[model samples]
Target: MELKKPSDNCFTEVDGFGVAICNYAGDQNHLAILYKNPQKPDDVKLFHVNSYKSDLLTPVESHYLWVDIDWLPPIRKIAITANLKNIIDNNKDTKIRYGFSFNLGCFDPVTGKINNFYDSADGFTCATFVLEVLKSLGVELVDWNSWPVASPEDINFKQYILSQLESYSVKYPDIVTEEFLLGQKNKINDPRFKPQEVIAATKCKEASTYNSIQKPAQLVHEEVLSYSN
Candidate 1:
């Protein structure tokens, strides 16, 4: 759910789900993911990413979170928003690298290792964060007209995400694009972000498509455990 409009409240659940509240103009930027336990109404899990968390990633980055429906306890609904207070740290006391803007803390006991944990990409800007999250869910928004389309060698993450969001807003006019662009401005939206790459020829079409496309899900051999109602 892209919280772009004044009355956009519902979140759609597909095999993949996403929630984004762009608050660029706000004093303190925050993002939170909440999970309520069905059997015990009082028990809840909260995950948060904000300016402070983003600041810890060296040069800093815009972060995102994606939770699988199967791994979670059944719940009637979820609340995703910006700027909630006093929430618990979902990754507290865990060996998993929790502070980075981009994190994959899902653990596998058999391997004694965490899946999708921190690496160089943890320095991603909001744009890269959104792109990676979408890629994880089998969607590729990358195209010839994609934002910050600099040569891969000179690509900047923040510019890329902002550009992508802008394109999405134009592509889906029914969805509000303004809110998606309103969050705390990234530290890197400089002149480099404005240059539009000209597609002189389709010579690199196949390679470009491959880079922009998502990896096939079947290639990852991880076993996914699921429970039924």
Candidate 2:
């Protein structure tokens, strides 16, 4: 995979599916899948699972850290893109919730079914959503079995999420419902797949050889600096 800048004409230069990583404030990041529209080959789009809302598959205008999977053959790329479009079409009306878990939830493209840790609703964090999509495409970005159990920091993050949800529920009572809060609370202890870890995994030549992310925040900072340079 090759990371390209906004000025690199990545949309036209690459003719296949890619991954986009966007860094945000508070050391947060987001992951999404990028692909060209089959009907309009020149139009590139992005698909991602977001928190507090349903999943989105929309066109790209914002610049992100575009990682082009240039290693794939043209035929394979076409097939993957088609499969992704089908997945999107099938789940167009499905309300996919946002939740976290240590386990990378399962996504079955054939049946258009999703199984997450909570098992209450179709849930996935932005990172896991992107990972599952790539997994469906026969691309394993990280070794699922290699991830360690939840740590103290992981637990703390879970608490943070709970608190944030509580605050949001109070502030936006209509949007953040009791059911949504319960679903998120159910998987609070599950191991998390951070966005930086996903970004690091993409750098690995093979998913099996990738072990773990030592410091996610530091890696994210470095990536941002590298992109800026």
Candidate 3:
């Protein structure tokens, strides 16, 4: 496989609550969404996209797919799952589960522009779809399949990525310092190199105003930004 990194455009500032993972190598790319069930996170449902047009996230093309979290106002938090079956020997000898959690508002589905998903406070969550571009950056295909069927707390990808990001920022502060992008790169390319710069990129938190909503808000209020940003 060709060692590559994600395009620079993928790391730009984004403004949507949705995500799209692109696979330029083959046609086996897949998308998955974590549907939040009120405050009960353990009960969240994960649905794999089958019908692009009618599904939560639409596939603009085989290499790109997206979804609007706003479409599901009831969803408190959403996790983007990247199916690395094609890139990695994505199969399980035993049923293992692992994933991380991030604030859902980090992505804006209504606007397709890029945004920073890192906050340096919340730590690493499942920003899978956003980091899919790392394949080209020489990130090993094996790393992508690290997700096991376990709770977010049980997963260690977040801490592993944080250390990577902190180091990359020290050497390359001029460019985008988001961990999901840069961390994955360094972790794969130079795992042994200890970075001098401290990694500050962390996860963001979702707003609490909607915590009491009984039904999906018809129209998301502009003031929602009070907490989202």
Candidate 4:
């Protein structure tokens, strides 16, 4: 059974992959992922992007991000909101890099490696990056956008998503359009995250789709792992 949702359509988990939600504003930002195990539960250290200029808001969820320091047991949701909107966006002339933040002392029980997805794409993979991260982390998926986004005359979210597909690198822009970004600010909102039968059924009929998309990421990750080793 799915766990109780801490917020509207938002579920929380500490052991397996936790659901992730996003909130982006003029200067404030929030990204949350849920997982039960903190690797070193007793002592935790989390590093995040210094570009963050605001105060890392404690997540509404019982558990949240960053390392917890301060003589505590239940890990405090840490954050990187220093330069957030406070300082200017530094590091110009740079394309996208992985992690885009500090290094956390998270570890993978299997490989004994730090549980950091940073070297990937600022801890994001596809435009469905947030969704994929939660899934990859082992959290189950739930439909978050069940409610219709438009009226009969209004534009459908599906089409909006297709139109926002200019950048293959990001995957789904509809997930980030003004509406989604705005909904994040409200205390009460829902992300009807559900499994898309159509997308998952096909074994990639479009041969180049996988090669063009997943290949680059796979190759990049392999290279990083090898270099680190």
Candidate 5:
């Protein structure tokens, strides 16, 4: 089930929230958002967690996806599940949930650009958009730092999402590697890994910020890890 390690995050204080997962193989792949509810985390409302494993492969496409909150019915909310379902056999079995409370802000209703979201220091809040919609909806701004923990095994859905994304991230380059790209060698062949997307989606970006400060793995923000060195 591509469930490598769990992410240490707590996205929601309420019952249901959102999430995203991606898996890639060769030149093909898939990504999706998981609408998770506390009532039935295993029987998730949307895509299931183990869905990534059905498409057996020696090597697969590892991609990024996110779980962010969105305004729904002006009171209710939904997730803006952004991902590529590159496989044909996406299982409906286990739908892993996320603890991150951040929601997606539309740049153009289809792009994952950070044109609007903002971050606060209150801790454990959702990803931010410039607008005060959530506040208007009665969601108090939380300290962003209280989101991500180190290892997912300590947390429930946080570990699940992180481990899954790590699994996919590890495989993404194999299918879309330099050798594979040199064949076509086009802009689209540039499979830039979005560690930030994984982090942002899981609400672990802020935690990484603290982690990097503690370890200083490199001297820059997490752009494309391949692009970093």
Candidate 6:
């Protein structure tokens, strides 16, 4: 599906899955899943596993370039939504902490099984979460092997995340446990897939190499806009 600005009927016009791409903190590009509400067919909502509180589902608003998965069949789309609902229901009390995983490719959506690294982190970045959900439905958005391994920058980012986790645990011990911190430490050198890589993948027909260094959000945003034109 091509990325384009949402029309006035952006919500009511669509009936299935899509991706909402927008900038966060005026710096990085972020992604969230857009799906038609099963109860209210005309309404759409955003489902994402963000670093903020684990509010997985919410109404769709704001200015975002909506990438609707127009190729999927209607029945499959409904199933995907149902699956997500079930996941939310099951994890109602448990908070899915926000963290990145290099082992996303190893996740088994059918069994809801994740690698030890992901299980320890207890969360996902918004982009990985969206990709994981899509992967559950047999939708592979990017070539996992073509992507570069983790770089020194990524390693430093891991250290930053560890510090954040330490602070979070001190403030909210009940939420961020010792086990969680250990999990975050397990995959220190793992390669991470950035939000821009996902955006660029949408425009590529075959496996393409991606730069190890992260690109500016605006550049990626403009590239996506150019694709729609």
Give the Cα lDDT of each candidate. 0.29, 0.68, 0.27, 0.27, 0.29, 0.64
Query: Which pairs clash inside model 1?
Result: 23-182, 23-183, 24-182, 24-183, 24-184, 127-161
At residue 85, candidate 4 shows an lDDT of: 13
| All candidates: CA RMSD (Å) | 16.4, 3.4, 20.0, 17.5, 15.6, 4.5
Per-residue alpha-carbon lDDT of model 4 for 119-222, expressed as tens digits?
Answer: 32222211233334322322223232333333432234323333333242256454334443233223122222111211221122231222233444343333
Clashing pairs in 2: 102-191
The numbered model that scores best in TM-score is 2
TM-score of each model, in listed order: 0.29, 0.79, 0.22, 0.23, 0.24, 0.75
Better of 3 and 5 by lDDT: 5
Top candidate by lDDT? 2
Q: Candidate 4 at residue 186, lDDT? A: 30
State model 4's lDDT.
0.27
Cα-based lDDT at residue 21, candidate 5: 36
Worst 10-residue lDDT window for candidate 5 reads: 80-89
Displacement of the residue 128 alpha carbon in candidate 5, Å? 20
Q: Model 6: what TM-score?
A: 0.75
Candidate 1 versus the native: TM-score? 0.29
Model 6: CA > 4 A from native: 7-9, 73-75, 78-82, 88-91, 102-118, 203-219, 223-229
Q: How are the candidates ranked when ordered by lDDT, highest leading?
A: 2, 6, 5, 1, 4, 3
Q: How accurate is candidate 3 locally (lDDT)?
A: 0.27
Error of 3 at 45 (Å): 26
Output the TM-score of candidate 5: 0.24
Span of 10 residues, lowest total lDDT, candidate 6: 205-214
